[model samples]
Target: MPHIIYNINASPTSDAGVYPIILSGANGANYRFEYEAANLIINKAPLSGIINNCNRIYGEYNPSFSMSFTGLKNNELSPIWTKQPRFITYADKYSSVGVYPVSVSDYDAKNYTIDTIEDGTRTITPRKLVLKVNDSDRLYYQDNPTFTYTSTGFVNGDDISVLNKTPEFSTDATIYSNVGMYAVEIFGAEARNYDISYIPGNLIVNKRVLKVVADNKTRRYMTDNPVLTYTIAGFINNETENILLKRPIAQTNATILSDCGEYIIKILGAEAENYDFEYITGLLTITKIDQVIQWKQTFENIHIGDQIELLATADSGLPIEYIISGNVEEYKSGDRTYIDCLGCGEVSIRATQEGSVNYNPAMRVVKYFTISEDASIDNINSDDYSLNIYTKDGYVVNGSLSQQYIEVYDVSGNCKYHGTDKKIHVGKGIVIVRVNGRSYKLVCK
Candidate 1:
């Protein structure tokens, strides 16, 4: 073997690098054999280490860590790691204060054996929390309302459910407390992952509200005034209208002699402790009494030359005046307010009483009386030539119908007219007039 020569003089080193190798024979002085070449490769030596444990406060990000190398072989230098191992944990910043497993992922360890990869631990500590309370108000003698608060510093979607016990609020104020400010306090809250703190608030006690009202009353003319009264509204705590330091006084400017109108009944001078009073006025109605005339007389069936006394009275104790009409005469003599009816034929008298300042006007009274039926138609002789019989009562008809022969009779069954004439004279009282087949009773004015 011609110079089974080799380039194997030196041994490989523990360092990592590439060295070239050539094995070939010198060309036997003339022709050289094809050279054989090869390369020697040295890789990095393996290393070992243990992952370090980490700690983090609750509601914070996970902290970074380092590794502890066990040793190196052949006194080799530690290799430069391109990628380091990673630690994984199920615990988050929001996790409760405790120890949690921190396992390591090799990442090939860059040829490093990560001993006790699962031996890592992450210790989480408590987070800071602030509970700030809200202010409130209440009226005097009122029950306290429920209090509330707001919190800061929660992490990883954690809320009040993360707390073992919620904070409770309280106050020294009571239903019997005076109208002034009171202290509101907070206490009793617990959570494993938090160190809680507080911001205090207050509650204000205010005065209560109430109203005083006057009662309305009414009175008639020439009558006594009614008693003025008052009522109270919005009383609390078993309080009544009698609890006022100065009770309301109700008054009005109305009297018996007042005209028919509305007057204000005012409520004034009301006082109470811890209560704001509002006064409300009422109405006082002064009205007039009704006055009426009393006359009862059905004067009927009397002969001529009859003399009758017209008598009537008034409810107002006032004298009644009488007016006579038709074929009657009236005479009022001296201070006596009496009407004398002396005449024949049909007569009517009206009695009236004018109203005074204390009384309303009386409705007039009237009565009709027939002394006798004068059958003599002296007034109709001049009007009989007219086509229509226009009597004192009214016009009878628009036009006459077929077989329209008219007859007139007096109340005493005396035939005044039996001729076929639609025109006739009706004097007074009630009379029957036959037109066609119908009979109508008419009264002359």
Candidate 2:
């Protein structure tokens, strides 16, 4: 962990000083802080800084220090003197916790069973059962075993049905006489005979079984979910398992009607999953023999809503995720097909584009106006005025502005203002103005 030292030098903001310096890694034990000045002795000795002068000195007050704030034995050391205009040290504690490795064991309860074996009427010796932990991480931990002849009807190699299955053994049909002192062996060292209780969630650990061995060298960790894992049959490339998508017959590439002719409809690599190759007829064939082929029934000319079967070889089993489209000679429509979306819970048929698209480009209209000079707040006596609005299509709409004030200004230091209350026609383009008393025209947009 890095020990960051925020050294607040006694000098003001004008002087050059290093404020915060981070000291980290294994070499941080030998890190030292130094304060030096030009044309003076550089302090290289490692010692904690001590305030000697009031604030400044004539020569140089260079002091180097090792981090030893914990051993502040001076009772007179003021807390305020150590804080203000002084360097401080702090080490992050969160990065110091040590991490250790742990392992877990798993078991299959269905595989093994338990049985009993007896000798005489008065049993001289009880056939004892025991469990062992062979991990070497525990020093002096021996391979201790326990008897499984307990009250829970436990037998040797019996599935651990209950906690009383420990020391689960019986002699001459007699149940456990003393239960507290006895220890029973519930699970064994076999990979499929033990269960580890460390994992959380629905414990379905299926990749590997729990084992008790002298060496815990295998890289198996405690997992939450467990499932039955098996291999797929007859697969060559490491038995590659994939998700296949089966859907209705659809087009992959759009049918482009560039010119009118007998065009053979070819199936793209993606569209072959929708149709069965062997069952389809009057369409292109996709087989191991020939991957792609022309349509059997050739269209004299391409048209919309034309059906074509796409066959894919079994080698390429899964269908590619895409829709097929084509352009017809009759209409130059976009790359979209109308279909019913059932998942929306409503009958929705719409044309959707396949790839990237650009929307329609449009132009914006900016009106520029010209104002007359004589029109102002001091001059307008009549209420009649004319307004003209025009469009890019060469259409003009006109209106009159009456009984309202018309104010205008130009870049050449000219002003025209008026009041008129009439219908005004505002249009998109260069605008012209007319005033009753003004003679000069002012361009004001």
Candidate 3:
């Protein structure tokens, strides 16, 4: 058996190669017993490593970096590091959010070259930003106001001026829009340092005030009422009456047959979405009509007994009342008037009409006629005028004629008609009529 005296041990920091064993004394009888053939062999170690990705907020600094190694020979296999690896990234607190390359500086694994199967890297990520739009309002048919917004989470105390691209605000409303609700949208905002979130807002519209007034008018009695009208005020944004949902209505109680008086004209029933309405009233006046009486002053050609008509009319279409001045026979109620002159004397008639609510009173009017005895009433045998004769239209009677007196009697001296009348009405029988002292016989048939 060949016996060895000194030994050789493998260390983690030892170089991998063939080495000679240490010998202070040799036990070989033969001085050169295989001294060149006894040697220890070491193999090269396989190694691998990786650098991790990283992230952070926009306002924060970069965190520390690390690397993980794989495929070491064993737990007992440890490599001595001559120099450690150094890592660096382009991302910083104020840097834009994007993929940035991570690089390496100096790295070593003892005397052996380290085969880095995976490359090391440092990653940068975007921070959060809050953006919001402000609410706004305006009246109907008015121009739009300026829009604005508020922003938060800007890094380094930066404002909207630091943003490379900014969003815009818009709404569904316009200057000519009516009263309603509309949406406001925020869109298309961009910045290098942060991710954005938009908060929506609202646009409001209010109603406007409007005034309406009724018009005044006038008319006469028995006339038609005028057409009602009104006036409007306070319109905006080049608006017209055509924009109204329902037009205003004017009203009154007067008609063509209404009496003479004052009436109230009112305004109401107006409608519109964007308006507040106020109403006003007006007045209508009616006046009385003038009136006159058409009549004559005097009549002609009078006799002892006669029947005549009193003709009189009023322009107001009212009835005429006949007033007699002396003793005369008259009929009161009818469209026509008749009077009887019983005796020879002067007679007079007056006509008048009282006023009503829609007409003025007519003026008073009068007319007269004279009565006389006839000269042909006497016989031609003597030319003397005597007290025993009474004259009528064609002849003379036996008695004198009084202005209001006439009489008729029966043959037995019974008086039938004792009133003032141009004609006598009696029962059927043999009857005697007496005019003054003269007598006439009538037969019943």
Candidate 4:
């Protein structure tokens, strides 16, 4: 059987296993066979072009082979997720912001860059994206950036019409303040109060400040002191008192003399406080005595001895009361007769006594003797005199006169004694005796 029983193991197609062989007839070249390649021989299959080129499943080319597939897939599918639209950059650049999303149009795609974002089409940097609330761009890395709102009349939800501008009360406003606000009170359409919180920040400064001032006025100037005099207007008695005396005349109720020199009047000037001025209209004094007494004898045409009672009364001057005894002697001058004083206190003679028609003794001077009875003369005082005697112009009674005589008589008309006076003392009553055979009856005390 010449090995009609075929040894299939030896045949090149009998074993489906990996084999190494040499092609002897082809110049001894080396060849290798994979199990799948030997199976393709056992199945009598033709070689595919993939296997015909090279099969590098488990060699250094395997990793490099899968990488090519990945590069091709990336190049083809990249446009699906990576394409962008046009967007705006910040017209003015900002410093510290980074990239962020922004709105855009698809037509603006050429404006995009790598490190920016886009809403749907256009790309934008975060520094260029302006926030609606503040109109400030976003900083790339800033957590929160500074901003300002440009809306009119909008604040932090407070009812303040005036904003960052200065507040004015009226046209002519008055602001009452010290250096700064410790407290404040205001009244307008409403009453408002504030604490130190009225100041917001330290952004502004006051270079110059204001100040205040005051004014005043007054009145007082029209009265002080003057001078005056005093006098009396009326007096109690007119004839004997002085009135209208000078100021400070006397104390109240004091005695004073009137102008007419009559009766006394009381004073009324010293008790006044101010100056007492005077206007005296007329005489306010008692110038006359109230009453008079009359005595007359030897004035009849028939009766030898006539007598009438006379009462003592006050008159202008002094008058005496006495009993008319006898006349010592009598003389006629003009139409009047004068009799010397006899032993009585007085003697009376008239113009019609013993057939006398006219007698005027106004120019006659008489000398007579004086007499005395039992009366002592020293008992009379100075106030009791009937006449105030003064010597006639250039004639005076000095020392004593000699040749004087005296007579003594009784009440019955009988002569008691007559003698030349020797040492007839003064202040003694004496009786009269005349010389030349014309003795007169006179007495003096």
Best by TM-score: 1
For each candidate, give its TM-score against the true structure.
Answer: 0.47, 0.12, 0.42, 0.15
Which is superior by TM-score, 1 or 3?
Answer: 1
Candidate 3 local distance difference test against the native? 0.67
Compose the digit string of candidate 4's lDDT tens values, residues 317-358: 233323233543444445333343334433432211111111
TM-score of 4: 0.15
Q: By summed lDDT, which 10 consecutive residues of candidate 2 come out lowest?
A: 340-349
Per-residue lDDT of model 1, residues 1-445, tens digit only? 4666677433544345566786865657676578767777765555566667777888787777656666565454543555666677888755779998877674553434444433578889888888887888989898987888888988778888888999988888999887788878887889888889988888888878787788888888767778898778888888787767888888888876677778899988877776777889999887777898988855766543234556688878878887767654455556344332223456678888888766788999988777664432212212344434436443233134333566665554455777655455555555555443333445555
Question: What are the candidates' C-alpha RMSDs?
Answer: 12.1, 46.4, 14.3, 34.5
RMSD (CA, angstroms), candidate 1: 12.1
Every candidate's lDDT: 0.68, 0.23, 0.67, 0.26
lDDT by residue (tens digit), candidate 2, 1-445: 5544343333331222234333322235676554343232222112232322211111122232211122122231322132223232221111111221211122111111112111111111111223432211111111223222222222333444533323222121112121112222234222122232211111111111111111111111121112212222322223122411331222222122122122223222221111112211122222111112111222222211222222211221222122322221112114322221101111111122221111111121121112222311212223333432222232122233434244332212223233452333332222223333222121222
* Model 1 alpha-carbon drift over 4 Å, by segment: 1-63, 66-79, 88-90, 99-121, 130-139, 148-161, 178-183, 199-211, 220-227, 238-257, 261-282, 289-445
Q: Kindly provide the TM-score of model 2 when superposed on the true structure, using C-alpha atoms.
A: 0.12
Candidate 2 overall lDDT versus native:
0.23
Count of clashes in candidate 4 = 47
- Return the top candidate by lDDT: 1
Q: By the TM-score metric, which is better: model 3 or model 4?
A: 3
